[model samples]
Target: MDTRRLYSFIKIVDAGSITRAADILHIAQPALSQQLSALEAQFGQQLLIRSKRGVAPTEAGRALYRHAQLILRQVDLAHAAVEVSGRAPAGSVSVGLAPYSMGAALALPLLRSVRERYPDILLHINENFGGVISEAIMTGRMDMAFIYGAGPLRGVQFEPVRSEDLYLIGAPTDGGEAGEVALEELAEVPLLLPSRIHTIRQVVDSAFQQAALRPNVVGEVESALTLVNAVDADLGATVLPWSAARAILDVRALTVRRIAHPVIRVQLSLVTSDSQPLSEPALAVHDLFLELVTAFDKE
Candidate 1:
C-alpha cells in the first residue's frame, strides 16, 4: 500500500469527514475516497463506516490509524532531518500573505535575505485576505501567513508580530488640520469600510457599537487598495491600517486623524498551523518576518 494512502486515511479520521479532510489536504473528495479504499484493500478489511452524521473508523480502521499516526510522525521527522542537513537549506516553502499586509515590504526583504543566505531554498508567496490565508494554513496549503486582527481560531496558532495604530482617512481637512475627531461627530460623514467579516471591520464596528453610533456608510470594499481609492475620491472616509494609509497618503490631498473615546489599534500577527511545527524554510521565513518588523519599529 502507498504510504500516502495511509496518510490520507489518518487525515480523514482526524477530520471526521471525507469532505473536510479533502479540504484540509487540498485534494478532491473522490480522490481521497479512492485512497481510503486502496488502503482498506491492502489491509484486507473495510476501514471506514459512513452514516448520516459523517465517517468513523471501524475496528480495523482504528488499528491502522494508530500505526499510521506513528509512521507519519516518523516520516515527518525524517523529512525534517533531511532538509536541515541537505545541500544549501534546499526545499520549497509556500507562504500566504494577507492582501494589505506589509508582506510586500517585509517579505521581499526576507526573500532576498534567504536567497542570498540559502541559495537552494525555493520560496513561494500567496496574497490573499485574512480569512483565506488562515484557511490555507489550516488546510496545509501554506506553511504560514501574515495576518492582522484578534482572537483564537481552532487548529491555528497566532504569534503577534506587532500592533499598528489605526486612523480615520479622508479627503484633506479644509486646511490639513490634524487632531482627534469624536466618533459620534464622524458618524454623520459618509463612510467606507471593509466587509463585516474582516477582523479590522469587526474591531471598528465594535467601537461604534460601544459608542452607540451607526455610521453613514457609503460602501464596503474587499481590499485595502480599493477602500483607500474610494476614500481618495472623496466618496467618504474609512479606518485604515498605518501601513496601508502611509502608502496612499498624498500629503496635499488626504487627511488622517485619531478617533476619540476609544483609540483603535489592530494587531498584525503571524498565523501557522498548530497541527505541526513549521518546516525549516517556513521557520526561516517566520524569523525573517521578526527581523523586518523589528527594523521597521526602529525606523
Candidate 2:
C-alpha cells in the first residue's frame, strides 16, 4: 500500500470531513475525495459513514486507522532515528494535562527541561479537565495525561504519581493561616467548588458524605483563577489540593490551612492508553514528567 495514500486517508479520519482534510492538506476537495475513493477501491471495503455533523469510521476504517497510526508513528520514528544519527530523538508529541494537576508550576519547568535536553523534539501540551483528557489519550489525540487516579479508569492505564492532601483556602482577611481545620469543619464554611462531577469536587463531597457532614456550597466555577480569585475576594472558602492552590495563592496572597480530623488525599496519577504506541519523543517527555512531578509533589 502507498504510504502517501494511507497518510491522506488517516488525515481524512482525523479531520472527520473531506473538506477539512482537504484544507489541511492544501488540496482541492475533489482531489481529496479521489484519494479516499482510490484507497477504498484498493482495500475493497467501505471505510467511512458520512453524516451532517461529521464522519465516523466503519469497523474496517477503525482497523485501518489503528494500524495507520502505528505505521505513521513508526515511519516518523525511523526518519528521526536516521536524521539525528542517534544523537537525539526528534518528532512531534502531544501530552494532556488535567486543569490544575499539571499547572504552571509543573508546565514552565517541564517546557524548559524538554527544550534543554531534547532540543529536536516538538512538544504539544494540552490542558483540559480529566474526562476530556482521558478520552483524548484513549483515542490517540493525546499520548498521555495527568489525571485524578480516583476517577474512572475504564480506557486508560494510570500510574499513581503521588497523593495530595486537600486544604481549606480563603482570603487572608477571612482566615489567614489559622492552622489545620477539621474535615467536618469545612461543612460549616461557605464554599466555592467545581461542579459536583469534577474529580476534586467529587472527592471533597465523598469525604464530607462519609463523615455525615454536608458542605455549605454557595457557588460553582471551573477555572482555577476564578475559583482562587473568588476566595481571594472573600466570596467563600474552598477545599483543594495544596498544589492546586500554590501558584495562584502566591499571586493572590490567599491563605491555605491543612484539612485534618481526617486528612483526605486525592491520588494524582499519570495516564496512558496501552493501545497507543509511545514514540521516542513521547517516552522522553513521559520520563521527564515523572521526574518533575516527583520533585514538585510536596506529599
Candidate 3:
C-alpha cells in the first residue's frame, strides 16, 4: 500500500471532513476524496461514514488510523537515519514559539548560533500566541515550540525547561514598592493584562481564583509590548517574566518587583508532537536548545 494514501487517510480522520483536510493539504477536494476511496477499495473495507456534519472513521478506519500514524512516523525516522549518515544535517527546521514566552528573547541568539554551527541548515521561526502555537504543533504545522505551562494535550509531549518567577512591573513608585510585592496588593492596583484566552492570563487568573483575590483590570491588552508600555506610563501594573518584558526593562523609569505573599512561576517547556518523527536538522536544533539552557544555568 502507498504511504501517501495512508497519510492522506490520517489527515481526513484528524480534520473530520474531506473538504477541510483538502484545504489544509492544499489539494482539490475531489482528489482528496478519490484518494480516500482508493484506500478503502484497496483494503476492501469501509473506512469512513460521511454525514452532513462531517466525516468520521468507521471501526476499521479507527484501527488503520492508529497503525498509520505509527507507520508514517517510522518511515520518516528511517529517512532521517539516512540523512544523518550522509552528511552534516541540512534542511529547514520550523519552530513555533509564543511571543510572551522565553522564546522571544532567545530567537535572535538561537538563529545566530544555528547559522554559525550549521551553514546549510535553514531555521524558520514562527511567533504566535500560546494557544495558536499548541494547535500548530498538534496539526504538524510546527516541529516544536516553547510554550507556557499547560495540561496534557492529545498527541503532544512537553519536557520542562525551567520555572521562572513572575514579576509585578510598573513605573518607579514613591510608595517604595521595591524588592517584592504581596499578591493582595494587586487587588488594589489596576492591571494591564492579556485577555482570558492567553495561557499566561489563565495561569494568573487561576492563581487569583485560588487565593480569593481579584485584580482591578484596567485594560485587556494582547501585545506584550503594549502591556509593558502601559505600566511604564504609570497607567497600571502588569505581571510577567523578565523575558517577556526585557525591552522595557532597559529604560530607567520602570520598577520590577517579584510577586510574593505566595509566589507564582510559569513553567516553560520544550514541546513536540508525539505523532511525528524529528528530522536530522530538527534534532540538531533540539540539542542546541538543551545546550543553551545548560549555558544559561552557568550565568
Instruction: Please give each candidate's TM-score.
Output: 0.73, 0.82, 0.78
TM-score of candidate 1 on Cα atoms, chains taken together:
0.73
In order, the Cα lDDT scores of the candidates are: 0.75, 0.79, 0.80
Lowest lDDT sum, 10 consecutive residues, model 2, at 170-179
Q: Pick the candidate with the highest lDDT.
A: 3
Clashing residue pairs, backbone N/CA/C < 3 A, model 2: none
What are the runs in model 3 whose C-alpha is more than 4 Å off? 6-34, 42-77, 171-177, 247-251, 275-277
* Candidate 1 lDDT for residue 68: 78
Task: Please provide, for model 3 over 216-293, each residue's C-alpha lDDT reduced to its tens digit, 9 standing for 90 to 100.
Answer: 888998776676667767888787887766734453567778888788889888888877867788889999977876
Tens digit of per-residue lDDT, candidate 1, span 61-94 = 8888866765665476468658677454567677
Cα displacement (angstroms), candidate 2, residue 76, comes to 2.9
RMSD of 2: 3.5
Global lDDT of model 2:
0.79
